[model samples]
Target: MKTYDAIVIGAGPGGYPCAIRLAQLKQKVLCIEKENVGGVCLNWGCIPSKALISAAHLYEKSQAGAAMGIKVSGVELDANKMQDWKEGIVKKLTGGVGSLLKGNGADVVNGTATVVGPKRVDVTRADGSVEQFEATKAIVIATGSTTIEIPTFKFDGDTIIGAKEAVSLRRIPKRLMVIGGGVIGLELGMVYQAFGAELIVVEALPELLTGVDPDCTKIVERKILKRGGTIHKNAKALGYEKQKDGSVGVKILADGKEQTIVVDTVLVAVGMRPSSKGLGLEKVGVTVDQRGFVPTDKFCRTNVPSIYAIGDVSGPPLLAHKATKEGEIAAEVIAGHKAEKDWVAIPGAIFTDPEIATVGLTEAEAKAKGLEVSIGKFPFSVLGKAMAMNETEGFVKIVADKKTKQVLGVHIVGPEASTMISEASLSLEMAAFLEDLSLTIHPHPTLGESLMEAAAHAMGAAIHIANR
Candidate 1:
């Protein structure tokens, strides 16, 4: 039996970082992966999806360039080329992950791992060889999640699919129907929509983006509606049928009525389920929750002290960055350093048109906690930079405590909202008051100035906009 100080399963955004960090801490680390390095987030999910979104965004922008006095013509999308480019990126990043693990002195093994004991793991390699390794210090489970598939609308890897197939489609659907209106569904749906696909969104919930700030969601929702797209909220996608014309006919229930919509493709992006089962966790006395998540303490330790879990397998927000942070914390803890999963907030970024990014408590959440709050908002419609880019569509909103003027949350919906949110995250982490953001001198004519302006508006001292 081979022995190592620590063993990490699943070389994902969570596992790879944990392995690298553990090796850096001078621990004998062995990282095992059943699939390509970087896991779903790199190979199938975040990176690939973002590449498609960027291509779609550029395509849409080029079509609208006439309005910006650029008179450009022949803006055509080569789906094959875009897909090849996206694959190149995934290949480079996944290769980098493997190189990083080797560079950090962590042993990388390709196989499926099953924990036979609290400290023993049995790995089955490609040649049907089973190798048992003992982790003298800790065994970290970092297997991420898989896309949840609706029973009625099974993935055909063609017309009916999940996010994995959605991102790799070389043929743009003439008409696309998205089954869920959550982050994944909307983001990818908007991508195809930008590529001239008539979009139909079926959301079971009353609103799109249920947990996101409604005001921010409203802007993206409005854009979809304005672009000849249909939204069916409080709706469910029951099933789908393959039509004679090689299209898909989807059955949906909304407002107590059942209707069938025919389209070229159906994307069921309902959500993801944690990959926790079949890992022999139960045999080792490690508890797996009802939702298939591995429950971990602040130190990323499970009920069994020798076993730890992190990332999507551990639970939601199911974010890559959150998983990476937890991986580092777990590595530190296992390395004899005192570290815990402690943070003011985990920021969320949505890549829908006019992108939405948020950090900390929302206004309703604060008020629901019975705390009085103040709200400040600044629209991009009036911002010079937004006008210059011809992408003026959303706003920046600040939620603060009425008494203390301490910023509780920051929400942005506009151009580059994803990039602008890091500052808000920092403010929340530092417990910055409204003045901390408002008093800062932001450069003239930048999208980020909206944050400073929103903070100023919260104090009723805004310069560019009327204080509300």
Candidate 2:
């Protein structure tokens, strides 16, 4: 048996970082992976999807370049080339992850791990060789989650598919139907929509992006409508039938009516369920919740002190960055350094058309908490940078406490909203007040200036837009 100070399973955004950090703390750490180094986030989910989205966005921009007085003809999309370029990026990134692990003095092993005891793991390698490793101190589980598949509309890997196949499609379908209106569905659906696919989105929920600020979602909804896409909310997809012409006829129930729509492809992006079973968790007496999530304390420790869990396997807000943060915290705790899962907020960035990013509380959430609040908004249409880029389609919204004037939340739906939300996240983490944001000098004519102005507007001191 190979013995180590700590053994981290599932070299994902969560597990790998934990191993690296443990090594940084001079702990003997071994990171095990069943698949590629970066897990789904790098190999199949975030990185690949963003590459496709970027290509789609650039292709869309090329078509609209006439507005900028640039007359370039023959705007075409080479799907094969785009896919190759995306693959190149994935290869480089996964390679970098492997190098980082080795450079940080963590041992990397390729195998599927099963917990046999509180701190003992049995790993089966590709060649059917089994090895047992003992973690003297801790064993971290970070298996992440798998996409949920609707029984009726099973992924055929061609016609009816999940987000995994959706991102790797070499040819854009002429007509695409997205089964969910959440982040993954909308983001990938709009990518193909930009590439000339007539989109039809059917969401079971009453609204698209149920948790996002409605005002921001409204702008994205309008853009989908303007692009000739159809949105069906409060709807359910019962099943899908294969058509004679190599397409699919989907059956949907919406507004108490049944309808069938034919489309070239159907994307099932309903949600993800944690990958918590088949790991002998029950044998080790680790408690998993009803939803299959492995419950962990602030230190990412399970009921068993020797065992810990993080990322999607541990709980909600299944984001890569959140997983990474938790990984570092867990590593620190295991390394005898004082650390816990303590953070003001975990920000979210949606790469939909025009983008949407948010940090901290929404207005409704603040109101629901019975806290008096004030709102400030600034439209990108009035911003010089947005006008120069000819992508003026959304706005920045700031929510603050009425009495304390402390910044509670910041929401943005505009160009580069993903990049802009970082500042908002730092503000919330630092517990900055409205006056702190407003008084801070921002670079002139930048998208960040909107955040500063929105804070000013919250205090009735806005210079650009009419203060409320």
Tens-digit per-residue lDDT, 1-468, candidate 1? 999999999999999999999999999999999989999999999999999999988898878888768887888889999999999999999999999999999999999999999999999999999999999999999999999988898888988899999999999999999999999999999999999999999999999999999999999999999999999999988887788999988889999999999999999999999998889999889999899999999999999999999999998999999999999999999999999987999999999997999999899999999989989899999999999999999999999999999999999999999999999999999999999999999998899999999999999999999876
1-468 per-residue lDDT for model 2 (tens digits): 999999999888999999999999999999999989998899999999999999998898888888788887898999999999999999999999999999999999999899999999999999999999999999999999989999898889999999889889999899999999999999999999999999999999999998999999999999999999999999999988888899899999999999999999999999999998989999989999999999999999999999999999999999999999999999999999999988999999999997999999999999999999989899999999889889899999999999999999999999999999999999999999999999999998798999999999999999999986
TM-score, cand. 1 vs. native: 0.99
TM-score of 2: 0.99
* Model 2, global lDDT: 0.94
Clashing pairs in 1: none
Each candidate: what lDDT? 0.95, 0.94
Worst 10 residues of 1 by lDDT: 63-72
Q: How badly does each model clash, as a count of residue pairs?
A: 0, 0
Among residues 3 or more apart in sequence or in different chains, the pairs in candidate 2 whose N, CA or C atoms overlap within 3 Å are none
